[model samples]
Target: MERRPRRRLLLHGLVGLALLLADLPALASSLAAWRITRQGALELRTSPNVSLQAFFEAGTRLRGPRVWVDLPGAPSRTRSIRGSGDVREVRIGRPTPDTTRLVLEFRPGTELNPADLRLVGTAADRWRMDLRGLSRPVLLGLGEGDIEGSATVAYSPPAPFPTSGAPLSADGLPVVPRDRFKVVIDPGHGGPDPGAVGIGGLRETDVVLDVSLQVARLLQARGVQVVMTRTSEVDVDLPPRVALANRVGADVFVSVHANALSMARPDVNGIETFYFSSSSSRRLAGSLQGQMLAVSPGSPDRGVKAGRFFVIRRTVMPSALVEMGFVTGGLDSPRLANPAHRRRLALALAAGVLQYLGGR
Candidate 1:
């Protein structure tokens, strides 16, 4: 057959070649906007929990409780189209019980024509929401409408949590009798995981790595053995980050990351340390929080909180996560961005490690 026009051919490829990895019957929801399937079975799924999955050909735009997908695929050249009504943001509460809706606000405009929207993946709640935006067919044109309006949708996901409780602190962590403990510092996010971006191209990974290395060097100078999750800018999944510390038989574990809140600047300030419920985690958070502030004077003290994060939650030893500063919002960004401030953060973290060992 003669080759179809370039644009048309590309559009047709949206369904994609059925691949071996794709479970044929499973339908994946697009994270962007509401979808109405025409032919073939569609499965809507969000990660860690499969929401909707079934085989179907014809489907209508069902206004559920919380989701917004881009208007049926649209032409590249089409800036705006006359939508019958307004479309809004989508919110997700839980995966097991998936609910989505559209929020629209209407204002008078001369022949309101809204731009065709496409769905982007969901934020966190696992890659499920993000994966929803993956596969979609193209809709090149739109019907008549001079619609002008806006809508907002909210998804409140049940707290994402894993199945098991964390290992208790120092109970049977293989901590040997030693002068100083072998501490492994894990700097969260690197490579592909930009973590969070800032005004000055400051990346979380680069900053944390620098701080981790500093902490390591400081500890080493004090006759304490030190190990780092990574020495270079590279991708390291969460699991492996902890494994490094475990592998090195580290006496304690510390995971470091800067916080970010773009939409709403958090009024909360200063350092907040987190530990798993396990006994080990508690001790670790206490130690880190105390010293992190000692080095960085005036650092906001959020105090130590407990939560199950992969690194600290699973570690067999005392573990804690240090939120050095809020990268976005409040006044934490400017200071965290300073090299002297970063060095102080490192030194304080190192000192915490020393203090924790001293406690025992």
Candidate 2:
């Protein structure tokens, strides 16, 4: 009987050993063998101050089930860096035992295009994540794809622009000026709020203001009454800007802004437009998008989208926000920095407005 008990214990121990041997594969796979580092953080002095980066050793296959961009200024109490341009902090964490996530925080008034993130494999065993070519706060994450596909896939523009139906009634129709049409033109981010800073220290406010003024002049030449939110360099709040459009009872409202994307992909250049995600604004948005593309032949067609921007949302009439070109783009930056290119952008904006108003 004593021998039987001893044999029983031996069998149990053998079973446990066998199970552990069988689990060796899984245990080995789960081991955190990959080396990760924030090595790119040292090069934060570059323009737009691409302040942070994460690097992973080769063979560390990444699979993200959740990736996104968080635009609210960095969490107030979290670990952070101050005044390194638009980016405030880069936080890394293990949301789960097996998952590692990188979160980028930005200062207020910064923006990021998820597609601008460029993940490059620098060596046989090293991959680098770069954050550059941007002057705004943007959040980007990767999910369910190879590294390259992850970020670009996040920028899924709408497939098609919606068309407008017949005008329901005279009261519902866009207002027409006695002689032609009237429009409210808003140049976004002025004075203190520089909106987005791009390559060679080009400020979004300066570019947009210049374009807005030129658009105003072009519209006036075509017999359209143009009411500008701010005629010169000055700060204009969102509420007051919308209030001016509503007060004038303009037929249509158009806000101008220059686009900024992640510095990693300086090649991403294009023009895009946003209207409220409502059917009422689609037709105008579509017209503007189509006309602008027609004038700028080589520019990438980013398509019209429904955005919940304050100015467009608050305005009573049909409204659209125009993102002329990428100020951080290699091709677009030089073009926008030049006076002739600014005039072309102005012409495109004016033409789009005129087309939507049936003035073209």
Candidate 3:
């Protein structure tokens, strides 16, 4: 009887070990590497074999300004890496058996605002945190309790378009006639993705869609061929938006979006535009910025910037992404909610597109 009991226990132990071994691959995710990009942002890369699940919590801790990234299911490990710019060092440790923690220590006197931190990536395997546009640092005395803030994850890489289309050339450039000038206007976010919520519960999706529709209408009135990525409140991924423009051989691609900051920053308001590659794209961005500023009185001109947003980057044509104004701004929210104001903004956008095309 004793021998039989021992044999049963041995069998149970083997089964348990086998189950643990089966789950080892899923739990083997770890911090593979990290580097600071030319933009002065911190980029973190995880093991690609498994999906990454990380929770970032940042604030002024009792010790100082710090950010804690918790990785559940990660193994216990201790390591430290030197940091650049405002970050003094990054320390990796196992806070609990099931949780791996990454502590980011900032230089003394660094004013860490959660709003300035933006985490963007398509997959968890690679993520980038932008901290270059931080406001001037201020000395907040240590032990001021926790000034809590959360980082916003934005943007994703473009996926392949769902439906089959005409095959592209060897260079991945679509073959189409350039006889007529074509434009594609994409309104950012819709349906399930309400985008940034602003003052009085104003949604970014609704605002941008209204502005884009008016823009398309005005452009059509001028006898220009216009294509819209979305005409109603429905979800459209970044891939199809870019594919449509490329397949049709559009001359220009413009995406409309509204800016947003924390609710605490009601005073922060501005108009900015983004473009990727080519001097022609830069010119388009400049034209849009100027016209929008001319009509949007009292709104600060945030200028044109280079951004690698999926829609703007993947499109073959000269493209620009315009952030009309801050939806969270005290001044901008009311104006954006007004149909007449949106109409004026639309007119300015249409005029900007015409201006760019005219110069071509």
Best-first order by lDDT: 3, 2, 1
| TM-score for each of the candidates | 0.50, 0.50, 0.52
What would you estimate as the lDDT of candidate 3? Answer: 0.63
Worst 10 residues of 3 by lDDT: 1-10
Per-residue lDDT of 1-360 in model 3, one digit per residue for the tens? 000000000111112110000012425435555555445555665443122223334434444366555444554457777665666677877776655666667766666555454443322244455654333432222111122222222212122211112221112112233335778888886544567889999999888888877776666656567777665454445666777788767899999999899999999999999999889999999999998998899999999999888888888889999999998999888988887788778878888888898788
Better of 1 and 2 by lDDT: 2
User: Which candidate leads the pack in TM-score?
Assistant: 3
Model 3: lDDT of residue 212? 78
Candidate 1, poorest ten consecutive residues by summed lDDT: 1-10
Per-residue lDDT of 1-360 in model 1, one digit per residue for the tens? 001111100001113111011111223322232322222111122222122211111112443122222211121222322232221221222222222212221212212111111121121111111212212322222222211112211111122211112211222122333555677777776544557765466677667877776766656556666665544443445655565566667788888888776636646457788988877678878888887777666667878998767787767787888888776645677777777778777767876777778767
- For 1-360, candidate 2 gives per-residue lDDT tens digits of 000000000111112111000011111112111211232221111111011122221111232111111111122232322224445555534444433334444444443333433332121111233443444323332111132221210101111211122211112122334446778888876544567778999888788877777777666656677777655444445666677688777889998888898767788999888999666578788877886676676889988998888888888999999888888988778887887777667767777777678742
> Which candidate has the top score in lDDT?
3
TM accuracy, model 2: 0.50
- Output the better candidate (1/3) by TM-score: 3
